[model samples]
Target chain A: MRFAGRVAVSLYLLVVSLGLAVGQRSLEVCSGCEFTSLHAAVQQAAPGDRILVRGGVYREGRLLVDKPLSLLGENWPVLDGGGEVEILTITADDVQVRGFVFQNSGVSHIEDLAALKADNVSGCVVEGNRFSNNFFAIYLAGSEHCSVRNNEVTGAATSEAFSGNAIHLWNSSSIRVEGNHLSGHRDGIYLEFVQDSSVTDNISEDHLRYGLHFMFSSGNEFRRNTFQRSGAGVAVMYSKETVMVNNRFADNWGSAAYGLLLKEINDSTVADNTFFRNTVAIYSDGSNRIEVTGNEFLRNGHAVRLLATSMSMHFTHNTFTGNTFDVTTTTSRSYNDFAENYWDNYRGFDLDRDNIGDVPYRPVRLFSMTVENYPQTMILLRSPLEQFLDYAERLLPVFTPRAIEDDRPVIGKP
Target chain B: MNEAVKVMKYGFFDLLRSRWIFVYTVFFLLITGGLLTFGGDPNQAVLSALNLVLLVIPLVSLMLGLSYYYYTRDFVELILTQPVSRPAVFLGHYAGIALPLALSFLIGTGLPFAVYRAGNETDAPVVFSLLLAGLLVNLVFSALAFWIGLANEERVRALVIALGVWLGLTMVYDGLLMGFIVLMQSYPIERSLIALSLLNPIDLSRIVVLLQLDIAALLGYTGAVFQRFIGTAWGVAMSLSSLVVWIVLPLLLALRTFRRKDF
Candidate 1:
């Protein structure tokens, strides 16, 4: 009697396993279909179901998902918020939101609103979406193991009083944000308390404030990002162990603007970056132990302005060309190490043909020091008298700090 | 007066024969035209062209001064010994040299930029400012050259002195001014720098044109002092008058020296 009971239990287990394999369902949500909106589709969906929302202007104001499902849209189905609230809100884990258009999140003074808001959920995916004229297009709050990819976020904010960030990440870990085109926002992408995340292949431009503003974020990486023409300035502040690679910073010109601003950040490696046409390319303050290598600074007002507090920076194999001033510092320049850089202002020759200039290249112009002290004396720039003074300063250095010399300035562009 | 015009007409034709006029005209044509054709935007073209104007205008003006005085010594001596009086000969010669230089500059820049402009309104003002600034610099330098040439006895000495003044004003004066600022970094230098810029015609012309080109706006500094420097009508009037002074003062000094000096 015991042997017969075991055989029956084994047969029951086999039947249940077969049912689980064939239980995955794909439900359609269209204007004419049974499940008309994403809300109705989510209500009927079980775990691991795929909800396909078809193309149309869906005035579905706010949607909530409680179960694990893939919410896919075909042909960018419009999710209009009606200027009142967020269009989509995800509350469950393992959720996917893709190929949708988000527009018109209401201006809020109290709450931090977003078009696609993900809260406290893990393994959420937001990708291939277009965002326009919205406040905080992709807001990831306390979410982990998520990815936001290939999204177009654009808006012109008249003022910072009511504007919001394009991608605002808060208290999130292991998020991957890549291939996004962002412009005209208060900030293109902002991160606070985010760790172990990577942002790559983003083109951010024309912001009233900053291209990328990160604060208190640690252990993050930025690669292949282009930031251009941001007005207020771009800053990386209070961060640790960050890596910035192959990024381009261009054309941020203002009295207070800089291409890349580093404040109180430590243990970072900024490599293969290009900075062009900024009033000040890199303004670093209180940042220590940063390795800046293989970068190009071209046609800027001041290539690098190292404020008084920075220390222990290593700049190697960088090219400085056509900048008004290569390196300007308020205090003496012993805080950093420079090596093997190429400067257009370098008037040295190599006798032995080693491709290394025989004389050390001095990068600081005395006029830059004057400008730093006065800021109003910039009218003397490019004057023949200033050029002569710069020539004289190189021979017998007086006003320029002595420690800002590149001993191994290469003869040719690196 | 008719005799003055006759001398002026003859002097104009004589200057037209010289190679300097063609080269001057061609240089302006190529630079302005090249910038317009390739420099992406009209504002950028103007900015690039300003550097050329500041450097080239003074150098060429000095060269023309030395050549006009030394190479044409025989002609001037012949005209002076004729029925022509001092004013007609001297003033007619001055007009002959100045008018051609100014006209060539105008045609060289004007033709190219007009061809490339496509009737854009904003571009016209920028080009106009550049043309006006070039003319101002040219006239000032030409006048200075005339004075230097008139003061010295030896032709070689006068030529050397004129070139020296060009170098000193363009290079050494600026150097000394820069060194002074560096040495006195503690004191206020803004008002002084503005005052110092007024002392050099090239510097003054540069600032006037650069202000019109909106370089301050390009650099994103909308400061009150910068705006007040060239923003108000009073500021405009002041700079224009200063430019006129640069033109008139040197010419008057040349006339005084020429009237008394023996050939």
Candidate 2:
């Protein structure tokens, strides 16, 4: 019995010693340590170790991350690009880089180098970094399951010809973009051939061009985002199965500015979005099988403009209050359905008190028709004669698009 | 005539007597001259100089004008007790300030032009335009200071009102115009740009100078739209008219208010 007890004690001590050895394998890289530079520490670190880069200006070259390690930048260490190529390049999976400043990237129309570039990598996290004065801030291509959050990207865009996008994603899937502030670029975020992405809680403002642009991408969701004072708030083209919800589009006012522009999009849902003070709320061209419901259009120049090629878009349960023109359609036979929308200018009565209009509410004003023809007849808007003519058209329902009528108009503002 | 000459003379002497004015003038000349000499492109240099002058000249002029008005408030009161008309006294004081400021700006900006003329002849006209811009800015600020002085009795209130007017003219007016544009997006009020230009003094000034440069194309469709609606000559006339009104109307209102007030 004594010999058996001694053998158990020896085995327990050996196991405890092995556990401590495994715990000490993950090294710490502090600022005041022997390894001064981040690159140096990264080079010395093995896989699954932590490289803690403390705060200072690391005037370093492009840092290539080839190991599956955690590289954390404490206190926002600045990594100047030195007017060259990318600042950080990731080639490994499960890498995490946080809290760094990337600046002064070189301009090349052909190369398209970003401050942070990740290619063919997966399960990476990039958060809390400042990207300024660069051509492109973050560029992820052919990557999967990566998360980018809480980053600020600002560019001093002189002209459209020489500017680059703040964030560019190409052929990436299952990516998450959250809580970023992007401004002053050609486009705040650009996605091409990307799929199954989620972009939420982001503010993209004052861009030289579109705030958010995605082309040939599908199965994406954009929620709780704010696009303000941009040339165009958002543009989705040649994509399908997308959802845009609870976004605010404001102050995007120019001759060609729009809150949202959809081209060749099919089977998308744009609901619960608020568009205020944009030149046009939604400009749809060649888009079909889309549902626009429970949205608010306030103080927009034109709430909805459907071109000749657009078809089969359903508009229901939306509020059109204080819009200059509720709807504008080019074709004679509009295939779209407008049902159960509250039009502030609707004059039809519901005698049964069911809140549904007895007569169908024709939302397309005669002024919009005239503007479509003349384009400068917009100067006559708000004039006393124009108001009189609008009232007459509402009473008569002539010269407006016949199919573009809201069947059930709600009495109260939605 | 003698009394008018005497007032002008005293105004000149009053500005020259302040040691801070000399230091500021010398510093302005040195800094502007250094920047122009070290600048890379002549066009960029002129633009930078114009921007600096637009931002700094008005501020300096306002400070100088306020100090002069406050220091001479008692003298102005005593002068009001005398036989001279208030408008004439005001005009004489303005002429005194304007002459010295124009001289300083020309001299400070001219030396660089003379040096740059060895390689570039067009620098002369550009420098001249920038100097004129500086003078106009000074006039606007000085007139504003005079109006503030006449409008308010307390020195602190007068200074605060002057600063507030300056901030409104430069910074807050653009923000308010943008807000107005956003609120009225549905209305086809592009024609309202004409009336809007008439309200802001800085926009009027920008239109005048930008039209003179004939680079209105750089401002894109908005500039072309503005040019088509209001011709170059009409824009300049409107700007001059606005400047005259900015000077005269404020003084008139202040004069009436001063006459009716207890002070």
Candidate 3:
């Protein structure tokens, strides 16, 4: 009786597998095939069906997939939008788009015209796609559990007035934007009202505006990303509980540029990042309770420009070398805390061999204070007089911010 | 012109062989080379060289010009006894001393950079600007030294004056300028600060180079004012002309004294 029951269960499982195999079909869409157009192929394709698109230009105006399907491009099939319409729009969950070149989407002011867009979709995967000169490259609106991986998005945007973001996420959560190379957009990756996303291993360069701009986005973690030569660099505003780690911000130098601008950001942690040659490595305004630790700041203008409005901010275990000013502040009273950070300008000694300087190091120079008050006094930069003033100010706490000293400054690279 | 060139040639040959010039050149080479090897970035190497150049080059050129003028007084007198005009003798001796000093600075700081292939197209301009600033500093300070030499009869007094001028320009003048600016902080002193900073050649050269090195730092409010003034083509032209004037005025004054002074 037991052997008979086991045989019946095995037969039932086999029958169910056969039914699924019969239901799910693989369709080929090529120039010589019956379904030449991707729009028709996606229409005919049922849920859980896989459509293989061959190497050919599919000038389908708009290919909207309303059902769950997998579209795999064999030889990087071109989905040319002809500069008049959106290329691929996914409306259903569990849709996967892989190995396609989406190009020349229509430019619009009222609507975002993306090469590939997902609306209210979940568990969608956009992988190994190349996007060129689209108004918006890969856009996700109200999407959850979506992943945009290993995509290359390049635009020739000149001005911010007409350009859109390369990868834009709106009201999306649990999204992963990883291993993407983006350039020449207004912003490389833009997150507005997004939450619980992870942006990792992305190289964003030469954008007209911010490289990674997110506002009202919370609990998003960014790691191992590089942002360079953008107009305003990376800006995190009106956000809380954001964590950025192992990222590099480089060469973002201009009148309005900053390596990282934390505006009204709270309870965030910035760790193990590198900032090089930026105008201002980190500019904090009205930020509170942020921990910046284990970072490297090299050759920047102002390593950290902390405003008086920032409260309870901690800077620790960071190495700052070759920067013009290690720290500059707007007020003489500092509410921020800087401890155990290695500053190259620190002149104190470590007689105890504890690797911490016995004498507290002051990062705010007198000249910086003077320049703060008198903006025209920047002409006196690197002057011996200013150097002397700063040296003297170090000896005596006169005009510099006394509260801005690092009590236990590190001796060498941390 | 012929007499001046001849005099310059004699002075140039004499100073070029001196140990001071060799040491100056070697000093630059070692610093620049060391920075390139260990500093990692060529532009950063140039930046380190800039501080040393700004501080040392002016003092070296000033002292070198003054002492050369003082020690070579007998030779200059002998030259003056020739058919050469006083202005020619003065100008030629000035060129002779200035050229060698400038050459030493160029070879010292420039050789290591060339070997390293230091800067790309973007960084090349910065390096070039730094070198230019050093050259201008050399010219301006030496001219001030020559004027002091002609004005003071006693070598000791001339040396003291030369040292004083160097100190004032390099250190004290900016202090005074700061004091002035602070006193007038309530007023709109961007234009005035520009005018006042132009008065000191060291401050002027420092500002010009600072504009290039710390432009990002300078793009803030006051820095923006300077960027507008010295960072623009017009501002650069203005500062360049001002530097030229700083070089010319001292020499012209010395020229007048050289023509009229007794042996």
Number of the top-ranking candidate, with DockQ as the measure = 3
| Per-residue C-alpha lDDT of model 1 across residues A1-414, encoded as one tens digit per residue | 899999999989887777577676889988998788878888898988889989988887777787788988898888888887877788889999888889888778898888888999999998899999887788999999999999999986889888899999999999999999999889999999999999999999999899999999999999999999998668989999999999999888766678999999999999999998787888899999999999999877778889889898999999987676799888865779899988877899999999999998878787677667756556666566556667787778888877878998999876
lDDT of 2 by residue, A191-257 (tens): 9998999999999999999999999999999999999898766788999999999999887876567
Between candidates 2 and 3, the one scoring higher on TM-score is 3
lDDT tens per residue, model 3, B1-263:
89899989999999988898889899999999999998777766877787877789989998999999987899999887877789888889999999999999998888887888734566776778788889998999899889998898988999888888878888888888888877888887777888887788777776666666775345553445655666567866777789999889989999999999989
Clashes of 2: 0
Top of the candidates by lDDT: 3
In terms of lDDT, which candidate is stronger, 1 or 2? Answer: 1
Clash-forming residue pairs, model 3: A375-B222, A376-B222
Model 2 chain B: weakest 10-residue lDDT segment is: B214-223
Q: TM-score per candidate, in order?
A: 0.79, 0.62, 0.91
In order, what lDDT does every prediction score? 0.82, 0.76, 0.88
Residue range B86-154, candidate 2, lDDT tens digits: 656666766666556656766776666666656876556656666666667667777777777777678
User: lDDT rank, highest first?
Assistant: 3, 1, 2
Candidate closer to the true structure by DockQ (higher is better), 1 or 3: 3
Residue A238, model 2: lDDT of: 99
Assess candidate 3 and give its TM-score to the true structure: 0.91
- Each predicted complex: what DockQ? 0.26, 0.02, 0.50
